[model samples]
Target: MIIVIDGLNKHLFGDVLDEVFKLRARVFEGRLGWEVNVVNGRERDQFDDLDPAHVVSIDDEGEVVSCMRLLQTTGPHMLADVFSSILDGEPPLRSTQIWEATRFCVDTSRLGQGRAKNSISYVTSEVMIGSFEYAQKAGVLDAVAVIDPVMNRVLKRSGNAPCDYLGTAKPMGKVTAMAALMDCSDERIASIREFAGIQHDVFLSEADALRLMAQRQEAKSPMPKPSVANQDHKPLSTLERYFVEQMRDARTESEVQDVLRLIESLSDTFTPEQKDALLNTPRAFAQEA
Candidate 1:
């Protein structure tokens, strides 16, 4: 399933965004050899600080399989600020109806081949469908994507090829990059869905999303088991240990705030009765001698 994370709800999905960035670091920096900023295993750029909308495809286990970053063309975007060489002196396209899509990637190492929902082909199409649907609903008529030749071929194979090209391809680290434009319309989305054999809604419920995210975190770094000889040592529960680790790993004030917000959202995962029961549970108490 896919999850749309934008400025409005970003505060609620910090962990999701973190996972997206980590995946980007692996693909862009580690795999593609791009000269991108990677801090603590997260590939982030100035555009990320601009609060761009992220359309991410998540697996049943809550792992981010594919993702694309969307930014309005009316503001500072890649073609305008970073990849000006591609434009070759022509003015950058700026309009409210046009948006810029960048950082498109998929977890090729994890997703296998075939037309199944969890396969790379299916997840790629699902991400594209989510992006187009999201852009169209947000009043965007066109999307300009900064992608490589390989990605261009993938787009063409998926039946969502770009309607036009913006500029010549230029060397970008290990691969050449170019700009291509695609119309964000129902026809394009339908074509991708048809190609991928996706016949139902792709969005996951909020509760399911949260649970998946928690599971993803656990899968990424499981807690170590306590040793038998350490019976005298106090051990934290899994939840408490995870919370402490998150705080310890935080590098900035914003990250600390994100950790707090994620903790706050955990309250919504349970009902009032469950919350009451958890709070009213009996615990051992020491009596004064």
Candidate 2:
């Protein structure tokens, strides 16, 4: 399943990003021989400290297999700081709606090679789907990535090719890099889902995600007490649970408004107890990311 680790929920994921950084060390520093700093066997850079969103794909075993980092283009990003040569002296694109995707890598040794589960092809598409879907929901318009020719071809084959190239490819230390732009649109996201044969939501629900993290921890301890323990504290009906999951994934205020409107429309269909559960979801999600 895919888990999005942003500043809001990073504390809940329990070192999933740390494992992702180790994979990057193996792929970029060990295999690809990039000049990235590998401290304590984890490949990390300055951008990681900026609270960029980490879209992570984990195997059924709850180990991070494929992942990517996303940073708002309005601030410092890879294209502006590290891979500026790809822009050929032009100013990097800076906008609130644009995010730079970097440090994309997969655990080839663990996943092996094939289009089936636990393979590079499968996880690559899964992570792409998560990143695009998450960004689209967050009101992002576009994403930029600095990729090599091999990865460029992979994107083309996976039905997620870049719509535009910012500038000519330039030689990096070990590989040539080109800045490619992709739209965060439904068409783009649908094409990748079709290629990957994914017919359901890629993300795990909040409860399921926390369970996965708990499974991976050595202590296997329960999560911290929720901040809303003083709320209604009533058990949820199936219908109410569905709305809670929907609201959990809703990012923007406008999206939350749409969900609230839908719940209001079904007032006559739900029982009083069920309706109360649904309406009280705001307290459960009072600390929404």
Candidate 3:
């Protein structure tokens, strides 16, 4: 399953974003030893604040196994901002039709080596398929990604060879970074899908995605009890209570995810404790039911 987190639906995916960051930390900092900003087990940079779209892949168990970031080239992005050095003094490519893709990674510990279910090859292709499909639908014509030689080979093997290269490969830390351009077109997507043996739509409905996300989150660690979640705990707002009640009244898993997304989206305006209470309401309902 795949879920896209953009500015519009980002609020519904705070937990998914959290896992994405951790996965980046594990791959970029831990394995690749790349020069990245990892704080408290999350890899992040200024580009994250620019509201880029994130294409994420989860397993049947609802665990976020892979993810990639997308930002319009017209705005502040990785290649234009932090990684402008890759241009080798040339100007960064900026256009509404072109988007930058970066921070592509998969959970190696959870996935195996072969191109099977829960395999690195499987999720990698799924992420590539999801990224191109997503960019194309968003009116984007191309995608620029900062990758190393290893990833370059993977792209070639998967039939997603870069159409062009922006600049020379430069050493970042222990590894080298090079900017590669790929087209977001039907032909390109079809080739990658065919290579990966993918024959179905690579998307999970927003409701189903949220539902899947909750399953993984609950499995990892239950939310802290509200009393100890924050010292200055505040009561839920009236509207917040309405959302929580709606979550309790939800009948199906789809409806549960929908109402939970609604409650979470509205939670940022309230206190931390209030948000916790809103999200934790579902568990409380399960207890009562």
Which digits, one per residue and each the tens of the lDDT, describe model 3 over residues 1-289?
6789998877567768998999999998898888889999999999899898999998898778999999888878878777789898999998999998898999999999888867999889999999999888889999999998999999999899999999899987788889999999999999998888998988998756755565554556534333333335444333443444455466788777876767666555567656665576564633322
CA lDDT for candidate 3: 0.80
Query: After superposing candidate 2, which stretches have Cα over 4 Å from the reference?
Result: 218-289
Clashes of each: 0, 0, 0
What's the TM-score of every candidate structure? 0.78, 0.75, 0.78
**Which residues of candidate 3, in runs, are more than 4 Å off?**
217-289
Query: What tens digits encode model 2's per-residue C-alpha lDDT throughout 42-110?
Result: 999888888999999987777888899999999899999888877778999999999999999998888
Candidate 1 regions with alpha-carbon error over 4 angstroms: 215-271, 275-289
The better candidate by TM-score, 2 or 3, is: 3
How many collisions between residues are there in candidate 3?
0
What is each predicted model's overall lDDT from 0 to 1?
0.79, 0.80, 0.80
Local error of candidate 3 at 253, Å?
Answer: 24
lDDT pick, better of 1 and 2: 2
